[model samples]
Target: MGILDDAFLKSLWVFHLATGSCNNCDIEILDCLTPRHDIERFGMLLTGSIKHADVLLVTGAVNRQCIPRIKRLYEQMPQPRLVVAIGECALSRGVFIHSYNCPLPLDHVIPVDVYIPGCPPRPEAIIAGLVKLIDQRKAQTGQAKV
Candidate 1:
């Protein structure tokens, strides 16, 4: 992966995908966009297309049907992209680990760069995770912390 410059890191475009979640995590994800949280302050904006995304926020367990689709999406994402496994479901398939449909954890399908664990992680946690992601990029580029 190439180094991500400060400008790109400051205005990351994110795409959210739900494989087969219960919608709880998705709800919290949306909550981050609400006025109270104002995730935009961090320069993160949601994108409708994965091709334009700098980060992918994946929620839910990876069911058999979602594997191919996820692979396709991951392949389509632009270079220097990041994947974040949000919620317990995406991290380990949660309670669905034993389910026949959920055959793989998210990491097995796509390279996950960050993990936010919770039944439904709060907006604050999501923001913190993303901020850490930006900081990590800064460190990688040998850019001093602001």
Candidate 2:
């Protein structure tokens, strides 16, 4: 990594936004922080507010009611914010695809940086996807391999 890149690299503060989910993905997200996963060891943190986050982990299908809120939240995030579509629902609306209320996937609401796919992806899968996101960020900024 270059000097400029090294100066900026640090713990990533993540914010979780739930459109409307069964909470399966939410649970798995939490699992990532537990003893077994130890995601924090990699410098990822879950923050309660979007303003403080470098990354946003979006869960659930995009229901009509939540569309406006989603856009607002996306807009609220700081510049260079990354969005991760967490779970099958956020990726494709999952079981809610057939419902009239869930008209669009998360990407339609905001740009997705990385997608962690699974009905409720295991914590391990989520971690892998996050690593990819981090590497992508490095590449985007012209940094050497981490």
Candidate 3:
């Protein structure tokens, strides 16, 4: 019944950020947008600017160089925003954990609402994770399904 109810889940605009990825996770994100997955069908859209986004889809590890930029982007987004860290790299730095350039995981840089783990999680997994996040939002706003 509130403004943050199911209405909020009707359309979720997302902004994608790649800190220091190998492009594998990026490609999978593209796959989610393609006709095959068609995430837009669920009212999920990839926006050009973080200011217009409801969710921040971050791919790749958080490196020293990208820390400030990523934090800035997170700050630019409007309130009631969600951050979904996609990929093993974003989750725990994966193979780059020992890399000198890798400074922290995505959450360490900014708060992460959900995490999709994989070298590069499949499109299906990405969609599922997003849905879960939406559901979590619904619950938090007292719009949970019966």
Candidate 4:
């Protein structure tokens, strides 16, 4: 098995970066960390440090002003880290796509893995994405099929 899979299974820390949002997606991400969602049960954790994170849970549209910071954060994370664009804004810039300050899609800046489709996906969906990441990790490790 490759080392990438081992690292993925051993730890799955999420780093949230709000480029430009209305708080709905942010709240959902927070809810996943709370007792109601019980993200820890699946070995998922929210992290402040990008260096230790395995997943990037990005919310909001990529604002023109925030582009550099977003690029910086993405570059700081380790090679194997995955990015989950978690909102309509993150996926296609939502209603803000043509806004003066909005930067369009998140893929314009960094590579994205899974996209949880919603203006703000539910906490359960966030947890499901985490599980999917774990499964992807396992598959990458050759412990399971893709």
**Per-residue lDDT for 74-97 in model 1, tens only?**
999988889999999999999998
Candidate 2 regions exceeding 4 Å error are 1-8
Runs in model 1 lying further than 4 Å from the true structure: 1-4
Clashes, model 4: 0
lDDT for model 2 comes to 0.88
Compose the digit string of candidate 2's lDDT tens values, residues 1-146.
55645544467888998899999999999999999998998898899988988888999998899999989988999876788999999999988899999999998878998999998999999999998887887887877655
Q: What is the lDDT of residue 45 in candidate 3?
A: 90
Error of 3 at 126 (Å): 0.1
Candidate 4 lDDT, 1-146, residue by residue in tens? 87767656776888989988889999999888888887877777888899988888899989988899988999999877789989899999988878999855898799988888887899888777767877776775678632
Q: How big is the positional error of residue 144 in model 1, measured in Å on the Cα after superposition?
A: 2.6
Worst 10 residues of 4 by lDDT: 137-146
Candidate 2 minimal-lDDT segment of 10 residues: 1-10
In model 4, what are the clashing residue pairs, if there are any? none
TM-score of each: 0.95, 0.93, 0.95, 0.92
Ranking by TM-score: 3, 1, 2, 4
Task: Tell me model 1's lDDT, rounded to 2 decimals.
Answer: 0.90
Candidate 3: what lDDT? 0.90
Q: In model 1, what is the error at residue 132, expressed in angstroms?
A: 0.8
Pairs that collide in candidate 2 are: none
